[model samples]
Target: MKNLKPMLLEVNANPSMRIEHEKELSPGVFENVPSPVDEEVKVAVIRDTLRLVDPHKQKKKDRLDHDVSTAPEAGLPSLCLKQVFPKYAKQFNYLRLVDRVAALFIRFLGVKGTTKLGPTGFRTFIRNCKLSNSNFSMASVDILYIDITRRWNSVGIDHKESGMCWQAFVEAFFFLAQKKYKSLPLPEQVASLIDFCEYHLAVLDEKRLVCGRGIVERRNALVTCQTDGLQLTPAAHTPLLNRMATASKLADYRNHQY
Candidate 1:
């Protein structure tokens, strides 16, 4: 038995010889030896590999959440505006500044914060503002406008106090815009117009200038239209004589006829 054990040890030391002997003695024993992989480990490896290869799946196992109140307030960045439109920034009044910022923010809410504003888009924006935030006493238009104006002035875009009528305000803005952006790129011009339109509506609201009321009031004034003649008719028309003072030529015509 001792001699047999020594021979077996010698055979086991040579792995090739031992395997051949084992196969001949018990071929089925190796066949039933269980696989080394744990099922849970295999499943986890496959899941990880799949996440890397598949573009549709997100690699990050967790997502971040943001609260609305935590997000910064959206508005025209005066510093950016000053750089973008230097001339307008320097000359724009406080009221004009307020209009532009409020209009752009309010209008953005109308289109879910995308797309260009339309001609009558502000009318719709006013409706949306009332619905969403209403006259919440805390953040009323007056308070908001004041805040915006102060910020704009701080950025060196010095605000002038001009309670000018809405028409004059709009005319002055467009004039400066034309001069400033005439040679600039198309994108800058379009952006200015968009901002200007928003500002226009805001100034009107703040000033309480009604387009319809202004038109009606002007139409009712007799002196609103210019004239040059006695009855104050249009200057382009023939002059009006004070009276029909030219003597009749009847007597002279009668003598000539005889």
Candidate 2:
């Protein structure tokens, strides 16, 4: 029973449960301790620490990290006007177009540092800025707006709090420019359009550019054929005769001609 008692004590022992006093009391000395203020302080400290390191909160953070890593737009850099619009890289006036758009965006919202716009705000911007005027038809403007809205929604942006960034405005502007100047050669049209809106280069996508080059090549081929007045249809292949029959025909033709 004595050995069992010592084993029970060992099993019950916890280092953290034991509190050490800074000052030791002498033998036969008794000091009246104050109210459990020190103990209360220790309990509060432990409670706060537990709250801060809650397992549930840690799990939520981990989930958020995983979502961010796996998101479709994960590796894409924040849309930058200069990087996307390389054609206007050296032009300060063109680069300032980003600032101009940003300023107007925030001004319309009446909120400082707010760079995003909801669907209604975007529509208002187009109307107020006269973006749909002149060469840009209302139908095309609506289409562009819908396209931007769909893209913005696909990224899981909450419409209640978040909206499309200013970069989308630049994209829409360039889209309209392309529509307006559809007849001109692509490079020449782009160059001419850039003079009006310095940020026109921002609309170009690498994949779209590759596809455009293919279309341009085909167009050039068609134009060449037309200029030469060549038949549009492919020439029919001549059927091959037997080798012996071909040789005899050639010999007969040679003899008859000579």
Candidate 3:
């Protein structure tokens, strides 16, 4: 595991608009990282294509016509682990979870000769996990709490969060300050969250620039709320998604869901 100390020290000492320097490595390659799995690992990679396709529908598979459209086009596949532990999938939305897990897997397990998961060795790891191909480009996704703790612990943080999203980062930042740094007060902890994201912009992966866009939007929204007399409390900070799912049940409210 890589220590974030050097990266942190460098950025803090000499902050600049110029981009930070990074190694020129190929995609999915990390230096000196080890495979996340071991003999003790109970989760196993599955390679059954039948799980994703209807074998009886051979005619459909043979068709080459792009004009033939279908409602609900074929969705991304699923990981064997989901099948083995159906209970886990029931608790969380697997579609989103798989993206983050796949990113971690690529970072740590892209070595040669590792057990393959699909068609090509890499594809096996991917399709078996049902990862979005776009995950290769994602800066970060909402990660599982366990994954966050595991990664943070590996890098020497005795205490950690479930994931490193803005919410988690904000809490951790204030936690370091003993919850007394109250220069900027709002509906909740909006300013503190933005502050953490601002600092993190320099340290996040270069490819994560896209992810930075969302953080910028959220930070601006918080600033606007502060300027306009809108409260920024934890309770008030509920995302539009929650509002859509709860308060807005009628068809007219659907447009606000975005």
Best by TM-score: 2
- Please, what is the TM-score per model? 0.18, 0.31, 0.15
Q: Candidate 2, residues 139-198: lDDT per residue as tens digits?
A: 766777778856856775555556666666666655655765888865445445544443
Backbone clashes under 3 angstroms, per model: 1, 0, 9
Each model's lDDT comes to 0.41, 0.57, 0.40
**Clashing residue pairs, candidate 3?**
117-124, 118-124, 145-162, 187-231, 187-232, 187-233, 188-232, 188-233, 188-234
- Residue pairs in steric clash, candidate 1? 100-199
Query: Where is model 2 more than 4 Å wrong at Cα?
Result: 1-91, 110-113, 133-140, 156-162, 182-258
Tens-digit per-residue lDDT, 189-254, candidate 3: 434433443344334455477678889999999999887665546556668668776765665577
The candidate scoring highest on lDDT is: 2
Q: Candidate 2: global Cα-lDDT?
A: 0.57
RMSD to the hidden true structure, all candidates: 29.2, 24.6, 29.6
What would you estimate as the lDDT of candidate 1? 0.41
Query: How do all the candidates rank in terms of lDDT, highest first?
Result: 2, 1, 3
Error in Å for residue 256 of model 1? 5.0
**73 Cα displacement, candidate 2 (Å):** 46
Instruction: Select the stronger candidate by lDDT from 1 and 2.
Output: 2
